[model samples]
Target: MKMGWRELIRMKQRFTLMAIVTTLIVLLILMISGLADGLAYDNGAVVRNLPVEHVALSQDAEGQLTRSFLEQTDQPAGTEALGVQSMVLEKQNGTKDDVTVFASPVDTVYGPKELATLKPGQVLVDTQYAKQSGTAVGDTITDFRTKATFEIVGTVSDGRYSHAPVLWTTLETWKAWQDKMKTNYVSAFISQDPIKTDLATYTQQQIVEQVPGYAAEQNSFQMMRIALVLIGSLILTAFFYILTMQKMKQLGILKAIGIRTRTIGQGLVLQVFLLTTVSFAISLLLIWTIGQLLPGDLPFRFEWTTSFGYGGLIVLTAMLGGLIPLRALKKLEPADAMGGMTG
Candidate 1:
């Protein structure tokens, strides 16, 4: 470890360049990770925040809540059918914004904290909508389609669907707004326990995929993230290999002077470990600072678990990169290596 530090200090310019490059790559990776998570949260926060473990959709709906038509008779015991529809909410100033309206039974317990029974003409809206539209509790919001107005009684976090903020209403009010009777139908059923009914059941992940454009967007972002990881690994490997080649003569001289090959290998691994650790720390700090400065509406989210997970991956890949050049060191003869002979 001392030798590794000495070597890095001796070749400060070269090692500094490598560290900067590694930091940039890691920063890009963290940013992309945040973006991916942000998009996922924006599109599926409502369903993800549900207390239910499984959602039962009509078999014929093909796993889509919007397409499902479930009635009270179809739901099992302890399950409440919910109605979901996308609509525009008009502000007093006539500014209309898209929102997903969710109508659940008054006693349903499948929403975020602070969620409770909704009375007629009263609604709970996502905090995002409140921030965007500058509406608060006691403010009235009108539906563009039915021209019905509801008082905003409270706010819920993580309440969004397909990138739209969600508004919670009573099942009776929702049916009335849609010009349907109470017995008409609901989109799906939410339950914490598993249901063995013939209807189609979907886990939270599956439900997220059912959101419009959610699957495709997430797939694209994930593929890009994977590509970035592969590219970063390759670059690190190549850099370390080149650095190793430059130090081969020194390594051979040390070996000739009784330094064990294992010791040399450990030194190289230590250098990579140090470089990756420092670079990852700096990158995370930069990300945190930038995240703090970013506006709330940018749809960017950062999680400590994700940062640690990616940092671990970077360290592992960088260490693996260092190990790739060890084969060359093992094959080198002290005489030939010192003499600068390739063979």
Candidate 2:
């Protein structure tokens, strides 16, 4: 390790260039990872935050809450009915915005205390939607289709569904609106107990993934991340291989002087570790700073767990890349080492 540090300091310019390349690659990976999480949250925050382990949807709905419809009798006795309606909200300025109305008993939603006390004609909205529409407590917004007005009672954080803001109200309020629309079915059944009905049942995570565009978007991001990692590994391999080629003559001289092949390999591994660690730290700092400057409404979430998780992968890849150069080192004979001196 000591010799590796000395050699790195001696070739600081070359190593710095390599570190910069790795850092940029890691930055891209972290940015994409954060965007993936943010998009997933935006697409299905409501289902992800439901306070239930299992959800039962009508067999025809195929795990989708919005499309599922179950008559009160169809809901299993042990489960509670949850109503989900995709509707447009007409702001006070007469502009319309997309919203999903969730009608469930307050205890079923993992939301603010204000949600539990909601009465008929009053609703809680997603905080993001409230900010975008300038809707606040005591403001009245109308349902564009039904023309029914609801007073905004409060705002709940992370309340979204199918990329639309969610508005929370009681089942009774939903039933009143349904009477006007002549519809008579809840969206799904939700419970901590396993749902044993003939309907399609899914875990909360499965339900979240079924949200429109959720699974496709996440799969796309995952593919991009995999491509980036592969590209990065190749780049590291090429860099180290070229560096090893350049140092072959010097490595021969060290071998001729009785340096053990294992010691030489240790130095190379140590260098890879140091370089990857520095690159990861720099990338992490850059991503954090970028996150701070971005708009709150932008779909980007940077979590420490994700950054560190990717950092570990990067280090592992770097180690693998360094191994290719070690093979060349192991095959270098003392006669070949002295041949470089003679030539």
Candidate 3:
């Protein structure tokens, strides 16, 4: 609408190039952010859903639940061991299914359900698994460990962990199976200690940090996203700089004719803002679209907060990037106009 915007459109090729580059950079950042979100969900959502806020695993290892141990003597008075395991179950439908076996002393977690009669060979399976396996209550499932068979007593809703349907096993049954398997590991224990444990107790975030490659993988994504931000801003600055510098004569003429430096600065900044907005919009759309195309089990979780945060970062980077051009435009000399006029 103003002379500044009019001038920006005059260099169609340069403006188009800047917009295209920004679009690509923004798209890349959005995609990476989506993947990062997915990884975070995959890392700990189901475990995190368990009511307790802190976790206790073997001080000896991290990540693999099979490596943790909770001695009865060392169960940390107020702490609860959330015993979990992998077991193969044979359904009445005559299909073999792999399930994560969960054994807890009480239903303090997973929406809180206390089974009055938890004994050997009585178990529960998640609704998702039951749906997939087409099994109903009173259906007996054989445990591959010690070949200890279990009868499906109840259907826990939406209980899943590490891509497997969860099954409820009695703590006693779990102990017996652990003895049979020779692993004797009870995935991880939870503590409601206004206190710490004799073993290493990790806060929720600390536990997430221990997930294999989560930190490194996140760092890699962050670095790439940051670089994309910088590059987009730098490109905007360089293009505006070149255009403004080359048009020093024109600026001088406009200044001599009473044009304000502020007006010229607006032109450069608006151009940057316009291109950046378009790039960011394209990127946001691309991320959502691509995420939709991903398989359900691919572990991509695009929370609104994360998506909005990344988009805001992209916009801020684009805005900050134009500061250099603002300075360069501000310092322009009217004298350069005469030099151009003379040439």
**Winning model by lDDT:** 2
Clashes of each: 0, 0, 1
Better of 1 and 3 by TM-score: 1
RMSD of each: 3.0, 2.3, 4.5
The TM-score values for the models, in the order shown, are: 0.88, 0.91, 0.74
Residue 121's lDDT within candidate 2 is 81
Model 2 residue 75 lDDT?
71
lDDT of 2 at 301: 85
Residue pairs clashing in model 2 are: none
Candidate 1 has a TM-score of 0.88
Q: What is the C-alpha lDDT of each candidate?
A: 0.85, 0.86, 0.69
247-311: candidate 3 lDDT, tens digit per residue: 77777777778888887767767776777777777777878888889876576766667777777
User: Candidate 1: misplaced stretches above 4 Å?
Assistant: 112-118, 136-140, 149-153, 180-183, 339-343
Highest-scoring model, TM-score: 2
lDDT of 2 at 160: 83
Evaluate residue 141 in candidate 3 and report its C-alpha lDDT on the 0 to 100 scale: 80
